[model samples]
Target chain A: MGSAMGVLLDIAGVLYEGDRPIPGAVDAVRRLRGSGLAVRYLTNSTRRPKRRIVERLRSLGFPVDPAEILTPAEAACDWLRREGYAPHLLIHPDLEEDFMDLPKSDRIAVVVGDAGPCFSYERMNAAFRELERGAPFLALAINRVFKDRDGKLSLDAGAFVKALEYSSGTPALLLGKPSRDFFVAGARSMGCALGDVTMIGDDAESDVSGAIAAGVRAAIHVQTGKYRAGDETQHDHRPSALARDIAAAVDLLVETD
Target chain B: MGSAMGVLLDIAGVLYEGDRPIPGAVDAVRRLRGSGLAVRYLTNSTRRPKRRIVERLRSLGFPVDPAEILTPAEAACDWLRREGYAPHLLIHPDLEEDFMDLPKSDRIAVVVGDAGPCFSYERMNAAFRELERGAPFLALAINRVFKDRDGKLSLDAGAFVKALEYSSGTPALLLGKPSRDFFVAGARSMGCALGDVTMIGDDAESDVSGAIAAGVRAAIHVQTGKYRAGDETQHDHRPSALARDIAAAVDLLVETD
Candidate 1:
């Protein structure tokens, strides 16, 4: 395969895990950027707005600009604007700032994210009502579970999305990771062709397998964050390379180039 | 075909639509009981305990005894006792009374029901933790939607059950309607063979098709609550007879005998 012209870097596990940056993650991004490769931050995290995510990255000493980050919330906003539909958001309260610029209209869509403790029955019912009334259902991501702040696996937005789908008898349009369009969007944002972009992340399924399925040049799986011992073998589309962490993945990319 | 020797009656739609009884439903039950057929009430409702359910039936002028009512809550309790596990109940607060008598232990099983307003992320995550730790997942019912008090379709326990299953990568054991074992238990309670008991209800899929699949003698579909036009055509197992309402279903049952 050809070398990567651009890179899609997963934010949470690859850079930091629960408020602490992975060893050498900050220097790795700088070295990769110094190599003249276009880099874009892509994340499935739905709990925070893009600004807050950028701020978090900055706090950890990563040289990231707000424009360099791409989130599902931004993609969802673009889709909402393109479709001329207003959203009834079932999302975490912290993420509300991303969709503030969308025009309000009577044609509504149900947008679901990881609402965390905000996933109340009343909120779910409200979203269900919107879907039942023929509103479009847009899900940010459908990852089944995520490592919670307490270091335990907890239900993610995907589970709640499945619930709403079951209740309303309506299928949801995915706007985040594992969606080919999401990876393509990331590639497009950096003016890179799908075949010239590589993804680096810890999640084997959504980050590695998803990028491979999306026609990226390669995906480097990192053994950090939520990576389990046998996670790499779980999906049919395996990662192109395995790295100890993002720093190791950067070394492979830089040395290969 | 042989005539029905006993009956399994669905509570919500067949007997009443919301708080109002279907026309002649009370008299129909009286006539059916007078015909010497063993009768049992089967419901999937997990919002209330058996005592409250019986109270509501009495308030509606139905001659329902608590001993004649069969609910998934009771079934779940029985199963928990048999398996020697204490339940970590993710159910409506109103239904806690039903499980209060069970012995408490660390061998916890996650029991999910229609929690209505009680479905919060904290509760769902707690249940997920139990499931992740090798706890058995028991769902009271998995009906997709239910007609709410507002006369609008709302999400039922099935939606939440699906969410937990998606998150934990575990299949749940069903303890309510549409579970063949549930129907068999209803028949067994009435001292009748499965082939000698008929089911009467409005839900084409759960009440009618479910009983048919369970090998009941017959299932009478009534056109009342939640019975949309062409519902019978939606399922592969057609009801033995279609009646305008529960009263008509009773007339058909009594006359055939």
Candidate 2:
């Protein structure tokens, strides 16, 4: 692969996993930045606002700025503004801060995320009612399952999104991972063309395959965070290369450059 | 069409809607029975137990025996007993009385129904965890939406069933409407062959199309309850006949005979 001008990095499982930073990830990120590549921290996490995510990254000894992070919530807000729609949010309470500044309007859109314990029949019905009233539906991410804090696979927002889609008969506009627009937005934020950027992450489907399908120059599959053995073989879109971790992935990229 | 020996009738839209019974439904059911056809009230309702449903029907002046109603919950219990699997039920609280008599065993099956307000994230995750452990997944119904008591379409158990199926990557064994086994079971309960039975209901997909797909002698789509003007034309399996209501459906059957 040719030298990339920018890199998109997945946070959870790539840099850190649940309050603990991956070994050598902090140094790897610093070294990669020193090599003069424009970098963006991309995540599908909807449980926290971008502020909290940046704070968490900083607390883990990685140099992160609020401006350097890209989230589906932010992307959704941007889209909502462009479309002149006010969101009737069905999202986690902790993540509500992200949408607090948006302009309120009568033109409503149902926005769904992982509401955690707040997912109830009444709430889901309320969102369904909105969609039935012809409101556009927006989903942050539609990944089926996620590794919960308890280390067991649990239902993610994608399942709830699917439920609303089934009930309302309206296809939700995806604003998060695995969507080509999300990847392109991340690349655009870094001031690079989609074909001049590389992506590194542990998740085969969302991070690697998503970037590859979005026309990224290359996507490196890293065996860290949520990655199981042979995950690379599960999807139709193969990653450009497989690395032991983000540090090794950085090494391969820098060496080629 | 050949004269039918048995009839499977959907309760909500065909016999009644919400608290009020459909006009002429009482006389229609009685007149159909007087014609010497065995009648079974088949419903996908998981919100209430069979006893309560029978009581409601009787109170509305429809002569109904508890034995005449065949609910998906009852069907599921029978399947659980036959398979020797104990149920880990995620059902409406009012419906729990129906499954109270099942034998306890170590082998567990996750049975999902319309739990109303009881569908919390913790409970859904618990069910997902059970499914992850290799337990059989059973769904009482998978109907996308239903006309609520408030007369608005609401999310039904089918959406939640899809959620679990997506998260666990396990297909649920449907024990309600649209499943061939549920229709066949209703016919067998009256000791009639599938070809000797006819179905009548307002729901085009679940009631009429489902019965037709299961090879019933005929299915009459009644234009009442949740039935919209163009519902009969929505699916490929068109109803054998379209009637204004249950009374008209019975009139057509008796006149043909």
Candidate 3:
């Protein structure tokens, strides 16, 4: 497998939903690997650290390397380190272990994601006060909604991110899916040019349209996981291919190759 | 001194700053009363009950009748009763006493205000679930920012309200200040026609512009609580007169008479 043949895979709603892997999703990844295709798991799950996420995938019988997962939290850490910004993280406690190595300073930058229980008025106000005193605002993902533990749709970090944005009159710096830079970086990490990689995801906007915008060769949108009826017509940039599930999506990619 | 010539007053930033009354506001209201002007205090303070607000005003030496205070909570309760909605309230605990008269049922309508400590991810998510199940959404006030107990600017209910609206794709029906119906109702309760009332407040949008849209005779923008520089130029509906503070606003009304 070379850079010319690679796939960027979305984890949630693509591989495993919550703790359970979608049926045939593991087999689909295995088939892609057997075909000599490069695979990188791109996720916007801000509720847990990368180590935990990798652990969950392994327990679910999926073969995943910790290094191959490109979570927005990890990307945000890399971006913050490069810019020399000290983060005042407003994220779930489970996700804080990822940034324990960063240097602490009074010069704080408000780093936020789907904090779950941590999204309190005090925490948000503290973040707002920091922004009012001239601190930058950063977000892991601005996803509107996510599947909860019970599998019902719940308010995601995007709503709170927008709240802080409106309250402080400051725009958030996005570092997750649908961000062109993040998508291109994922392609580069796979040792592939943006035009060589095929993106696969359940979300039309974040995965398919985002990969297209980032210059991916093609994107396959799956019908499972958060896909509503008429999503294909709802966007100006339609997915290059559509599949019933991860199995069908992998089959389409193999046949096309 | 009758319904033919009435004045609508705003609380908080106009008559008082936190616990302390604004320097001549007490005397200004006293003068308005002495002149036999019909006065109604229109407030969007969802943090406290109307009884507490009336008590606070009395303690500050401003002669305020309980009937004169028009709180959004009271208006919301009235609307809920009339519309036959059993609300799932997301508000400060202190304000819950105001809705004690409402009958309870499983059919929920999300009633939100400045929820203060009651604003948690669990509660917000619960509200989101209710809305997803087709519950109607209502808001007492959606003011962007409010002065906290610590005298610092804090994120108000508007941020959360907008978040819920974005998450559910449902618009919240506002029942507080800046709502045209609330304004007109306050005028009617005073036995005054909307065209005979003159509204005065520090907030340019909610108080002045709202009054103008409600067909009030005139509106005076006061430079007091929550009023920022350039607020006069920010709105399309300019105030009929500008005043240094509540005292000056009262003076303007008296001079015109």
Provide the overall lDDT of each model, using Cα atoms, as 2-decimal numbers: 0.91, 0.89, 0.85
Worst 10 residues of 2 chain A by lDDT: A144-153
List, in order, the clash count of every candidate structure.
0, 1, 1
Candidate 3 Cα misplacement greater than 4 A, ranges: A1-4, A104-106, A209-215, A228-238, B1-4, B104-106, B209-215, B233-238
For residues A56-96, write the lDDT of model 3, one tens digit per residue: 99999999899899988888888788888889889999999
Candidate 1 C-alpha lDDT tens digits along A1-257: 33689999998879998889999999999999998999999899999998889889999999888888889999999999999999999999999999999998889999999999999999999999999899999999998777777777788899999999987879999999989999998999899988999999888788988889889899999998888788888887899998999999999888643
Model 2 regions lying over 4 Å from their true place: none
Per-model B-chain TM-score: 0.96, 0.96, 0.94
| Candidate 2 residue lDDT tens string, A81-140 | 999999999999999999999997889999999898889888998999999999999999
Model 1 RMSD in angstroms = 1.9
lDDT of 3 at B10: 90
By DockQ: ranked, best first: 1, 2, 3
Candidate 2 TM-score for chain A: 0.95
